[model samples]
Target chain A: MGLVGNVCVVGLGLIGGSVLRAAAGAGHSVWGTTASAADASAAAADGFDVGTDAAAALRRAAERDALVVLAVPLPSVGDVLRLVTEHAPGCRLTDVVSVKEPVAEAVRRFAPSARYVGGHPMAGTSASGWAAGSAGLFADAAWVVAAEDGGDPSVLREVTALALDCGAHVVPATAAEHDAAVARISHLPHVLAAVLAAVGADGGPLALALAAGSFGDGTRVAGSRVELVRAMCEGNRSALLDAVDDALGRLGAARGSLASTGSLGKTLEAGHAGRLALTEQRAAARTPLRIDLTAPDAMAALRALGSRGGRITALDGAVALAETT
Target chain B: MGLVGNVCVVGLGLIGGSVLRAAAGAGHSVWGTTASAADASAAAADGFDVGTDAAAALRRAAERDALVVLAVPLPSVGDVLRLVTEHAPGCRLTDVVSVKEPVAEAVRRFAPSARYVGGHPMAGTSASGWAAGSAGLFADAAWVVAAEDGGDPSVLREVTALALDCGAHVVPATAAEHDAAVARISHLPHVLAAVLAAVGADGGPLALALAAGSFGDGTRVAGSRVELVRAMCEGNRSALLDAVDDALGRLGAARGSLASTGSLGKTLEAGHAGRLALTEQRAAARTPLRIDLTAPDAMAALRALGSRGGRITALDGAVALAETT
Candidate 1:
């Protein structure tokens, strides 16, 4: 792939549509397709090059050696990968699916010949569809790019460049690690939100009326599309199960303490410390670092930086400019 | 008590400071005392009647036959009640403490002669101290007023009028019922947030870095002051324990489905339905009603309306103007 290749996005929903807009805004030749005729029409009406044919889009991407992004939801990943296999057998590929390991698995199973690099831009709104997307959706967001052992550096560079161009910093991790981390930070929260919402609602209208900021903020995401939430959560089932177990264990301990001792001191203190850590991390002074992409241990360095909460701010030729807090 | 009686607020923290501001804004005779010298000076500098002596404040409240508002935290309630007993025995009383049952119990044990009515305004920020408060804090908020059997109608009317004058709609409930409802809506969310925050932090810095809107919103209240959170959660131990058990049950079911069937469909769907219920309740059309405070069954009517989520929007002479959605 060239330093800045043409971009082809499959699915013109929120993430995909935003990718098309952002890539084009970054000066890449960009186009996308969607199964939803409404999304296609919306994108087309907005003067974007969006179509309703996945095969045709993949064929054109193959001809142009474009970086094909699977921006579809988890349920649609396999079918799109099949199309990629038939139309562009070994195209430079990446994705913006929420769960990383599952998408990576799908790509390996259906389009093994593709030079794939798994990615997930950690950004979205509760809204969906083409009309709900914008060029700035990913600005200043963390975009996770998988750093598998023995992975091709060239394809990784291609993915990193795309993410950086779309106005996001890169966070490198293995697909498994990405899945595990997100299960705690993303998927488990979704499940908990659902539970909290249901429980709050069960308190009848009085409880709902008494609900204030905490309830409103805690259950805000429960208002997201249910099927979409279920798809991402279930897609990362193993990792999410572990997170759920950890949460339940903590909750059980809290309940035991409250019942027997009338104190939630330990639980509240731990949570307070955790929140303080987050605040400190966000407010910490960042130190700049650069990794030469052509170096023998470039992938290792990238993964190490990401594991320590570092971000690749830009791709400077074969070097990745990064910062660590 | 006069129709617009004097309001004496002890413990000038966020809620107390706001009460002073709002009551004064509503043209009530207001005065407050705080243990924190900094808060006392700050409130005094703001041209409000603030002091540091609780006994002196209570003595003046006794002289004026004021409606005393104990806005102290749960752990301090007993100490403040002892002072109230010595200085203002049988004076009109209420409180803005988060937990209702504990405060009521304290009142019964320490100052049983005080004409007591329990209250809790369902409004707050994650901030504490006088500087963090404002007159508009309770605007359009639900201020719960306990409607116990054979409770004094005059005392309830004074509290109701104060809440309405402060720009809050009054929600009448039995103290025990209020505690149970808040456990589900207010206290459980705090525990869950703490658990969620701690779990996310356990994923290491990478997880925190990737924490987006969902994680942030879900754990927002975990950032609240740990001591304050502990006091309220521990204060309502029984009801919060039940709520915690309910949450754990739902979480266990979610985990089971994920482990065996790789689906969170039921949990997500229930959450969606719960969120929909909240939306519908907020959007439901309202019907106006009024209860004669002098009537024999006024307390029953008020409690019944409150149990159904009805709110007293205004006090018209001897009547409570309310609405049910």
Candidate 2:
């Protein structure tokens, strides 16, 4: 219940570096760790207190009241949790891994004494490494917090405040819910884009030559780091499998509707409605993010957050934050 | 064949305005047509000779030894072709519609004047309108020329040269090939994106809010002009239906592969190979295009063609061209 005064981030990659920057900018003493001397030295040079040794970094972080965030990949999260529990056993810990059910289960099994919560900072670029990190990267992004059955409310509150400090909106969900939601939103889309890129490959030389902004934009993430996507797919296989099946079923329905002799307008309308809803939700969430502003003027502009009495917290040198009082 | 020193573009929308800019930048005198007086005035102000009436534009175009480029929507292409043949029957004509088979069939049925050739610029953005048009838009894009059975080579050459002048690589495919290729590459992707958006919508607000770069990038084009997509789906129903079925079958295979204790690495490898092939093809084809250097480092960079055998044809302000010898 102590004030969330210090934040510790493990991994020091894009997501970790971003959290470090956002937390540091929010007046917290931020601590970071990496697997190698090279990454630690690189992060330290960027004004973060990162150390070469993970155990040493954890010991330094445990000196103060800190909220430890495991920002590693899904498969590695469990091992990191075990290490943190053995090294800095008293500090509260959470993870920024994308998939949660397995990670939560691992935390429950390995780190019984520590207050461990599962989190996914639903923000990142395809770019990785400390060099690719940005200060305001997590601004206006979603942070999904999955609470286990016996999870500590004080630890969850500290995690919530940390996410909010990084200009993220906090959403509470179960570990299974979090996994299913991300499977529908993130992992399935990556697989679909991967297959889409495959189709363009068949056109031989001309297809790539013929690709314009649409193709490039559509397949932008198809070139994502293969190892990361692989880990994610393997960790959340069942949920992702269900999502793919659901997606195929929807495609089948559209194909059937369009092929029917009935009014094609209904099928098109359904698609239009679905697109509008998705875009509306994205805009609602993205109004606070600092993404590129390259869209044409004809698109919708950001509107004010109405009637919500939540206190708005600001980070220095970050994007806009207007709180409703 | 007479000299095609000038070209008239009817309907100053995305496709038409882009043609005028490309044609003009490629050393052809360009005229434009607009139904509204305001658009005509804007076109004239923008250095194009504008005609308020379609027939008048075609006649004026013929008087100046120009080819008429029809750049209207799919539903209206037939009417414009009929009007062009009735008014300026001697002028060679071409059209830039996305779905070629239906338009080609319509041209055959409505405008049997062998001067009308079916053309499609395989380049575009999610953007539309005159302001969105750029001189370099078509540079290094693909131009598909579908030759009618026993059609005039002179007309085909004019369209091909126009395509080349726009700095596009010319790909000659039958209307059937064009339709099938686009169905697999273009229409199918749109349908899949729409389906993903639908799935995201069904997951409720929290899931939609968690949509990151992958979801946005994958479904970016789904937010494009709904009417345009609808028209494309309706016009190319048969090909699109087959493509949807094919995509569903692919997804089914992936689901099976993942469900079984088989190699997830192979599934990942298939995606990797698909993306790598497309990337390699783009790199090879991009050797002859005047791509901008300001794009993100992750995006396809436009390097000077001097290293290759290709040479810059033009570089004035925003318009740049690299042509292969």
Candidate 3:
């Protein structure tokens, strides 16, 4: 296959719909399936190849030897993986779900023979469903492709290619690392936003009225669909619990200092430094590198690159062109 | 006195500079002073009256019976209040500090004879200094005015007019109530943002690379000037401690639920509900009501309106025009 190939996306929600559109837009033959009648009809109305039957789509993917992208929520992962096992077992599989380890486990349980790679594009809006998706949604976004040791390098390359086709740079890490990182950056924020929102609400209308930019920005994600938020957070329960504990410890220390010395200077200063680190890292110049996917230690190289904040911007044949800040 | 009066603003930083510009724009004779020569020079170069000598400005205010608006940070409040006592003692006094109770207490300690009311505009940018200030900074923002019982109605009206002139709706609350409300909304968010930022940073550069809109928004205020953030949070120490305790309780509950039942549905649902309340309240139609500031229970009436999320939009003679959602 060239840099692109046939793409089959299961579950045409925001991420999946966008993946389908972006893949087709990148010159790959793409099609998708959705359980939602409205989403299926909407996708079809948009002149894209879409359907409501997962079994039929998986069968086509099986015959075509296409890369099947699972894009369902955590709760629905098992059901779709069952269909994949029934119709497209042993095919190249990847997913766009938020949590990685859980989905990988599900794939292991339901479709053990499949060549599976896990992925999560770190991009989304508060909106969901087919109509809310866009081909440009993943542009310049970080798409994590799990770099499991002993996994097929060809499948990994294919996953990286798909991510690049969707206009996202690929970050390669193990499923456990990806889950832990997202637990800190994503899931913990949801929980914090929820707690902050509830506390502000408990202060009654006056507190809400006095809320300004900080309050609005901090609690913005709490407005996300409750069920969706709960699913992802709960799916990564272990990692998220660790993150929550770390945050609580810091908060407790801050409280202790405040109650003792009337100073939150230490916590505020550390946070300031952390924010500065983020700003500087983002603004730092990138150094280019390449990893030969066919190399003996390619997976380890890719994992190390991701750990150091490097991203694979393009796949030149089997040579993964990467950059690190 | 007219609705607008002569205004003397101490500390020509973002808030004070903006207040000076706005008051002048509103046809009040406005002048300001700052300890920083840079801010004073910038304000002076803008062709409005400004000086480095706060004592001179306070003396002028004393001569003109001007309203002395103390706009210094919490740390510098005592020094400025001392100046007010020495030069503008017994003059109509108010402040634009972040915390109210501390400033109110400082007033009682340093300038007991001055007719004092505390104010805090719920508006600011991450940037600071005279150059960053704009006359429209507080437009449509909530400006909390401490409505202490036995606080002279005239001083309350003066502060309300200043807030209205600066294009902010006045939220009448007691100093304690204002501090408590802001602890929940402003100070608590700052703490949470700091904690969130630190946690993301702890996940290392990979996590920062994966940080998306949610993480960015949740920790935006963590990028603010460290000393300024520390000052405000530390100034509201007592109330912030309470708010922090409440947050810790909620977070602990979330962690427990996640560990025990592997579910965060209740927390997410409550957050969703809280966010919805904010949206609905902001969008709710307002019913206009007038509070006669000279009435026997006028202060009580104003506090009641504020507690119910009402605001005084304009001052017309002794009748304060207000609206409630």
Instruction: Find the candidate with the highest DockQ and give its number.
Output: 3
Where does candidate 3 chain A have its weakest 10-residue lDDT segment?
A: A1-10
lDDT of 3 by residue, B185-300 (tens): 99999999999999999999899989998889999999999888888889898999999999999999999999999989888988888888888889999999999999989999
As a whole number from 0 to 100, the lDDT of residue B94 in candidate 2 is 82
Candidates ranked, most accurate by DockQ first: 3, 1, 2
Tell me how far the alpha carbon of residue A168 in candidate 3 is from the true structure, in angstroms, after superposition.
0.9
DockQ of the two-chain complex in candidate 1: 0.84
Tens digits of per-residue lDDT, candidate 2, A3-105, equal: 4388888888888888888888888888888775676788888778888577777777687757888888766776787787878887888888888888877
TM-score of chain B of each: 0.96, 0.80, 0.98
lDDT, candidate 1, at A165: 86
Could you tell me the lDDT of residue A221 within candidate 2? 69
Kindly report which residue stretches of model 1 are placed more than 4 angstroms away from their true locations once superposed: A1-3
True-structure Cα RMSD, model 2: 9.1
C-alpha lDDT of residue B74 in model 2: 80
Per-residue lDDT of model 3, residues A1-325, tens digit only: 3545889999999999999999999999898999999999999999999999999999999999999999998889999999999999989999999999999999999999899999999988878999999999999999999998988999999999989988999999999999999999999999999999999999999999999889999999999998888888899999999999999999999999999998888899888888888888899999999999999999999999999989999878999999998
Off by over 4 Å in 3: A1-4, B1-4
TM-score, every prediction: 0.96, 0.78, 0.97
Q: Give residue A54's lDDT in candidate 1 (0 to 100).
A: 93
Model 1, A129-192: lDDT tens per residue? 8989999999999999999887888889989998888899899999988999999999988999
> Given the true complex, what DockQ would model 3 score?
0.86
Higher-lDDT candidate of 1 and 2: 1
